[model samples]
Target: MTEALGTRTITAAVLVIGDEILSGRTKDKNVGHIAERLTEIGVDLREVRVVPDVEEEIVAALNGLRHRYTYVFTTGGIGPTHDDITADSVAKAFGVSIDVDPRARAMLLEYIAEKDLNEARLRMARIPAGADLIVNEVSKAPGFKIGNVIVMAGVPRIMHAMLEAVLPTLDTGPKMLSETILANAKEGDIAGPLREIAERFPGVSIGSYPFLSETGPNTNLVVRSRDPELLAKAAREVADMVAARQPAA
Candidate 1:
């Protein structure tokens, strides 16, 4: 059944929320991970927003991104901490009631004795009604799915685990194909012709990843496309373009 459906282009947006992120107390790594993962799963990451813990900002960002993209994944602010407000903001965005879900409560109950599961811990159980849970094996506080949005934890390890638990349930498109050519050059020197090739192959995405080392300047030109043939075609053009600019050696 899955094979019958060929690869389809999908666009996605990510929302990273937390005061710590905004204040520069913690640097966010999830955005980079999600972008790569989406690309691997045949989804294009069109937009990313890092918002503070404020509810109004989160709700607005959520409503806008969910409407604009195929899927919206939010990381952070879903933990037991006092500042964890992603769930509440998402509930407001969907105009739903925030309450302790029976399923989530049950899951919490499994790990903690009833006497020990106090209101503070129950905070983790409060999910928007009618949303599916994303399992967190590292810490049993499950993430929730409301509409097209999947809200997960901020901690990298738990967030990755939750993603693993939920990713299988999602309908993924065709994997994107990529070809890379490494050359001894700087990005500025190659940016112009690369842009032209990118324009020529409108169906494919051409990106230049640059690095500096004792070996001298280097750049990896990456060509990505859903079509393998198109990716190869673009890659060849990029290599030719780079070679034309390379000094005699």
Candidate 2:
């Protein structure tokens, strides 16, 4: 669901496809890249799902994400291979026909010669009917955007480029403002105070993240809110809470 503050907040989901990702053979990187970029443009990344190459799984995920969020971004399985079933699965999800888009084929020709575009390589041109192409500056293969679903390549570089091309077409929402306070105390020391602060500021989201460094364990208290004023106030309260617990020196 789209988050609402003062303005309508646009939310999106990243569906990472391919069995390689689940198998640990290929770690998924597009989620973070897409999430950060989308946040910069005021889009909230609501959900992320990684599914295998199974067509049924892809279709089910597509239907769920597309309907749930303002926009759905799917990465992987659009390449030219037998396992690249994202295009066809997406078609079935939307009840549309899949065909070799002339536009996509034309784009591929710019990198691969017409005669050299073999059957496997030519599969890159297959797109769901009535979908627009997302420009791939890194690779000549184009991604497709149909309805609220945007399908892009799995490679981080290529996905990053495609996201850039599609940014202009999206409608963003209110930007989230955040503030971080480094608490010298351990996470356990700050949990009680953090929870109290969270209750005090219902509009602001306060999270306590703990990390172990070479020196010792520390807590990173982060406050986030759509309202900058609220965020600032909550952050100040958090700082005060941390200071109150310190022994007088």
The runs of at least 3 residues in candidate 2 whose Cα sits more than 4 Å from the true structure, single-residue gaps closed, are 1-5, 247-249
Best by TM-score: 2
Over the full model, what C-alpha lDDT does candidate 1 score relative to the true structure?
0.86
> By TM-score, how accurate is candidate 2?
0.96
Displacement of the residue 23 alpha carbon in candidate 1, Å: 1.1
Q: What is candidate 1's lDDT per residue for 1-249, written digit by digit as tens? A: 122136555678999998888888898988988888777766778899999999999999999999998889999997777888889999999999999988998888878899989888899999998899988888788998888999999899998898878777777777778888985688888888888898888888788899987887889988877777777888999888878887788
lDDT of 1 at 131: 95
Candidate of highest lDDT: 2
What are the Cα lDDT values of the candidates? 0.86, 0.89
List, residue by residue over 1-249, the lDDT tens digit for candidate 2: 225365898889999999999999998888888888888888899999999999999999999889999999999998888888999999999999988889999999998987899999888998988999887988789998999999999988898889899998899888887889999899998898789889988888888889998899998999888887888899999999988888999
* Worst-scoring 10-residue span by lDDT in model 2: 1-10
Where does candidate 1 stray beyond 4 Å? 1-7, 243-249
